[model samples]
Target: MSQGRMASGNDSSVTEFIVLGLTQQPELQLPLFFVFLGIYVVTVVGNIGLLILIGLNSHLHTPMYYFLFNLFFIDDCYSSVITPKMLMSFAKQIISYAEHMAQLYFFSFFVIDECCILTSMAYDRYVAICMPLLYKVTMSKQDCLILLVGAYEMGFVGAMAHTICMLKLIFCDGNIINYYMCDISPLLQLSCTSTYSNELVVFIVVGINVVVPSLTIAISYTLILSDILCIRSTVSRSKAFSTCSSHIIVVSLFFGSSAFMYLKPSPAGSLDQDKVFTVFYTIIGRMMNPFIYSLRNKDVQIALRL
Candidate 1:
């Protein structure tokens, strides 16, 4: 709420930032805390359970499930990075610049990793459904590992880019962050210096992260749908659709919420609304992924039972 003074030059006057949290109302604090606590609990339990199940079951060790394993891991970590600090925010926590930068780095890393992994999962589905004969050959252990490694590598590079750009900005005395965590948008709004370079980097990096993976997913599903349409058997068609339905649901939710948050122009007044959108991908979506995949996936259900 404070329109603090802008940075004079390259030097930063502010050493730390105050987090205003999701809401300033005294009444909503306890209720929101309990709600997010419940979300964090479910997110941890579900993702961890899925990770353990995949690790223990040999049948679930294929390319698809391998990707799912990493997905769950990232979701667990992603939720961890934001939710706990979010909980602390209800009590009004202050974070130093170094701490905020660390949060930004990890947050960016896991999100980009999720995008890449989801893209990989789409390709895995494409191969399995469109070229069943070569699924094994195409999605071998080495290939899966390469995809996983690439996702991590891309994540590191993207996170580094965002963090480094942020480091260049100078902050004046208006050190209050309106959101629950140290997100790039809110942090950019706090800078005393001109944020043109930072904003541009955000646009370019986010554009690539969102657009590239989205295109990959679209092409994969297009090919997949074409193959499915050619099949004559009703049961076969339904089976193929079922295999992809869960992924489709997840991709829609994750990409939709994330793109809304990062890709849009962050007018100074939109920070309040940003928190609402942030809740979807940061907490709710992560919590729902395991359920969405497990309920729709027979293998996961079977493994859970066993």
Candidate 2:
């Protein structure tokens, strides 16, 4: 029933947070930092290089790549949100309530953006393969722009809603976040106030974010597969199936990690493994996407050659 620190009369003492990242062990810090630094380096290069490739090649400006262009942007920004903080981690960060909220907000924004963008991309592929002749008509430049805009909008709305709900809860127990980032689950675990409502909202929204998009993706690929199976030529079927399998792998890599992160119960005992999965989702996921989706791709190969 109590308000957040802002409205609570007794919360004047709690001004900032001490964020505890991955590990507290002295020996592990340097090694993990360096290792994540390498992962982040690859993330930066891969996403930026893919972006440039998509931009420069006029032939690559089709609807699929168009969706990918946005996806790449989201991937880069998404990793940037969490990885650098992990890399530059100190013993404990002096994070204000506002800063804490901002970090969680932006993190949620980009994470949800990735979800929506992936769904949009799946829809793009569905239209491209299942309804080839209607692909251009269905996914025009305007429609593509609308989809991109909607993805951003969905992210913004979800972030704002979560942040607002978060601000309503009081956090007097401790200002230390056990996880690397100010994620909702870890933060909720730290709340002193009754978190029934907060947990409910988290469950509902996260269910929608993970489940609905996952189902959409499943249905899209199912239709695409059914359409692919109807093709008669062996070479054509093999090629289409290969591309489809690659897409499935890329999608699985992301969704699997994401579901593990957001869909699980709150941080309990040793969260070391959770932190590792968090790293995979926030740091490694983006780095892998470009390679999974396009590293060996013929179009990207051609573009790079040019």
Candidate 3:
């Protein structure tokens, strides 16, 4: 809640920024810290466990699990990028400009990668379920590799765009970020210079990241659903739905929370709402993925038993 004197762009820039953690209530800090610490522990364990499980099990090396391997990898890295620093913010951490920028860049990179990877997973599922005969040919090792590389390339481009735009902004005023971590919206809110350009970039970049993947998933699932319905046997239909249901749940949770957080105009005094939405994708979403896929997936269950 601290305020700084409004200074001109020519004035001294903020050397560091204070992160006002999830809540200012003294009594809640320790409890919240423990809670998120537990979540982080589970996130690391669940994701890494899945990664190792997939790597060791030769039976799970199809294109679907190939995407799953990368998805878990991204989730692990994504959670690490945000959660540990967020835990420190409970102590009201002060981060240097360089540190904050690094956090921003990496966070942006992993998040965009997650979006693209999820879209690729949906495409993989579509091929596996809707066109079973052509799955291998269409999603060959080389093709899957191309898709994975493309996702990372998009992440790199999006992160660079955001970081470069942030570099142009002057933070000559207050440095307290009213949220838990260094995110695009909260950081933009702290800028002392005109953020019109930054906001435009956020909208364009976030729109493409959110919309394109969403549309891809939507179309893929639509075709998938159509194929599932054509199966005359109830058992076959059920199996097809089962194959896709996990991906659908994951996509819904991730895209729903992320789009809500980024695509809208961040109104003044909305940081609290922003924090809630951010927790869904950043913390809870990552924590839930491994359990969702493992518990729902028969192949993973079989691999675990073996």
Query: What are the clash counts of all predictions, listed in order?
Result: 1, 0, 0
Weakest 10 consecutive residues, lDDT, candidate 1? Answer: 1-10
Model 2 per-residue lDDT tens digits across residues 1-306 = 222234346553345667777878889988888888899899889999999999989999998888788888988888887877766565445667787788789988988888888888889888877887998899999999998898889888888888999888777776777778877877777777777777777777778777899999999998988998899999988877765666677678878887887676764535667777777878877888888877647788888888
Residue-by-residue lDDT tens digits, candidate 1, 1-306? 233333444554666788989999989999999999999999999999989999999999899999999999999999999999999989856877788899999999999999999999999999999999999999999999999999999999999999999988777747888889989888888887888888888888888988889988999999999999999999999999999999999999989888888777753648888989888888899999999999999898898899
Global lDDT of model 1: 0.90
Error of 2 at 99 (Å): 1.8
Question: Order of all candidates by TM-score, from best down to worst?
Answer: 3, 1, 2
User: Which of the two, 1 or 3, has more TM-score?
Assistant: 3
TM-score of 3: 0.96
lDDT of each: 0.90, 0.80, 0.89
125-196, model 3: which lDDT tens digit per residue? Answer: 888988889988999999999999999999999999999999888886678888888888887777777998
In model 1, what are the clashing residue pairs, if there are any? 7-192
Cα TM-score per model: 0.95, 0.92, 0.96
Query: Model 1 segments beyond 4 Å from truth?
Result: 1-12, 266-269
